[model samples]
Target: MNISNNVSSITAHQTLLNTSANNIANVNTDGFIPKDTRITDNAGSVRTNTREADNNGSKRSQTDLAKEIPNEIIAQDATAVNVNVIKTQDEMLGTLLDIKT
Candidate 1:
């Protein structure tokens, strides 16, 4: 049982690290906000063998889909711009071919 708890904690810590890394990666991103992973003891459990993120406070906002919408839009816009650039290049090539023929 102790081994299982230890493994669970380790896994939680790894997840925390990944979240931190992703936050750091987007630190310079416009309107990008960093998120923190919190592990808390479950009060309902007798032994409380595991921890979870407390979603009662500001942490609750971290996982909010509303907040993520803007970020998703920004990413999509960036992708669209790249696609448009590629399409323009293709169109230009086609135009050049038309002139040659």
Candidate 2:
């Protein structure tokens, strides 16, 4: 397994989680345009880009709980999967070295 890809995936998911958290945190703020975050991959490197939402005219923030909650859950699960992959790879390496010895 490629550690860099796994790490990049983890970083992307972490960014997703952070974006969701930020949106949730500003749910009650007036005129707070929640940031929309998107994860993209380039040359096997993952990254997150966030942009402010538009079309919100009311004083109340346009943050949606229904969407943010699921986004956070998905990001958390993805991050966990990437971490598990790294852990499993490490274990396999250890086992290989053990057999070598």
Top-lDDT candidate index: 2
Q: Candidate 2: where are CA atoms >4 Å away?
A: none
Full-model lDDT, candidate 2: 0.89
Best-fitting candidate, measured by TM-score? 2
TM-score of each: 0.40, 0.90
lDDT of 1 by residue, 54-74 (tens): 445442223444443444454
- For residues 1-101, write the lDDT of model 2, one tens digit per residue: 57999898898888889899999999999888888889888888888888887756888889999989999999989888989999999999999999999
Go through the candidates in order and give each one's C-alpha lDDT. 0.49, 0.89
Worst-scoring 10-residue span by lDDT in model 2: 50-59
**Number of clashing residue pairs, candidate 2:** 0
